[model samples]
Target: MELTDLAPLARSSIGFDRLLKLLEGSRLPEPADDYPPYNIEKTGQDAYRITLAVAGFGPDDLDIILQPNLLAVSGKKADSEARGKGFLYQGMIQRPFRRVFHLADYVQVRGAELKDGMLVIDLAREIPDAMKPRRIEIAGGQARPAQIDTGHGG
Candidate 1:
């Protein structure tokens, strides 16, 4: 499944091109709709966290890699070496899978932890001082005067 020309017109903005690409790439290899369920949360103005339900997966079975602007999560459950017991009905899942998430500009993966059969991935975004919203001070009674520099070179 892919997002059809996802918000193309957004390119009119100054720095939305990269965002489009990130969205596009993340959609390429759709993460398995199954396996450990996950949730993405926005904690602060620039902080985010992804929680995954990895019931039978242990810390050693999971791997998190951060490269440049890409964050990838992968989990591989160890195969069982038990005898085939008589079971008319069996309902258990044990498969390996990988999920990739593209991080936007200034977004960084902080860390990941497992607790209560849940895997949590932490992310944070830090905007530069100049980029963050700022209020321009208005002088009470100040008029800016422009000086015209005429090049008078012989």
Candidate 2:
């Protein structure tokens, strides 16, 4: 099913303005370039992993940066290294690429590693204690009895 607009739904929901805004913003046109395919998987309840197929790129050629709720992954081969590569049948993609990801609140990048021509980036959602759901103790209607001093005079 295709989602056209969420304005009506946003009007009915409470405290979901940001979520609807994100959904609406995602409907915008995406980049035409599909270089360096990637996958995002949920490893755990709050853990996630993003793996990119960077066959022709290495650790030095790739850069991952995180700012606020944005994540950018870019790769570019060195000028000297890119030169002297004369290929008759060029099938592998070696061009520079930049991919940006919109992260949710409290989502942080834990680490990244490159192995077997794939770049893996680890992420986790760390909700603060104050933001987590907590149980509130309900007090009963019964009141405690007051203690009277029946001391020395009595």
Candidate 3:
């Protein structure tokens, strides 16, 4: 869909005004996202884990990609393995898939490992020094912040 096609949907929600403003006028065509199923878990205070079900995809067939605040995991079967004779009914969900995740500020992908057909993606929240609360240095006695009333009555 074109950018204009999504304009009407943004106006339907009152709370979405802030998000719409943040997105500005830039638009990305809707993508036909893949679905093989996944799970996101809060592993620690500042850690998270994303587990994707990739039953037939091995470690070499998967790729973890990070783009600014977006993380994507894509997988494809390793060149159709030569099956032995008498093998039939490929029932496993072995198709290629790509999954995307939107990350918050300071969030970083720490590690990724595949085990038993499950792809685990580790994430950690990196609190920037500027954004973290720091104790203010008091030079003996610090002056209070000033509040200026710039409005003048006529």
Candidate 4:
């Protein structure tokens, strides 16, 4: 319903500003449109898939963009004289639409495909080598005693 107040967290935290901003942005209500419905699914441990029902759209009519932290998908029918022709009862919607997806860190677009009136976008989270968890070998021996040498001649 409402965004939680994060001003107190902002004061104590250093790099959580982005999270706070995301939460604030989500609080704003957006117009609900069921047109061009979509589904997000998890295919693998670190892989995801987004499928959109694009009945009349072709590959050329769609555009997919990858921003720093967002994935945007848009569709626009190409201009043509035939499209202007009058139709008795047009039920299918060919209007342009844009959809955005917020991505977490390290998430990247793998590929996309259009099949049987459905557009599928694949994503995978590939963590960098430096950031992945690694095992550290701990020392496995007892501490050695310090050697002492007495002064030679008094």
TM-scores for every predicted model: 0.63, 0.78, 0.65, 0.83
Which residue window of length 10 is worst by lDDT in model 2?
A: 1-10
lDDT of 2 at 140: 92
Write candidate 4's Cα lDDT for 91-128 as tens digits: 88888899999998899999999999999999999999
Pairs that collide, model 1 = none
Worst 10-residue lDDT window, candidate 4: 78-87
Q: Which pairs clash in the backbone of model 4?
A: none
Candidate 1 C-alpha error for residue 147, in Å: 12
By lDDT rank, best first, the candidates go: 2, 4, 3, 1
Writing each residue's lDDT as its tens digit, candidate 1 over 77-154 gives 655521345557656554677777777777888888999888998999877888989898977876788977788754
Give the alpha carbon lDDT tens digit for every residue of 77-124 in model 2. Answer: 997886678778878888999999899999999999999999999999
Please report, as a residue range, the 10-residue window in candidate 3 with the lowest summed lDDT: 78-87
TM-score of 1: 0.63
Candidate 2 CA-lDDT value: 0.91
RMSD of candidates 1 onward, in order? 5.2, 5.4, 8.7, 3.9
lDDT of each: 0.77, 0.91, 0.79, 0.90
* Candidate 3 structure quality by residue, lDDT tens digits, 3-87: 4554787867776764575466446544666577889999999999998888878788888999876898888875546354345
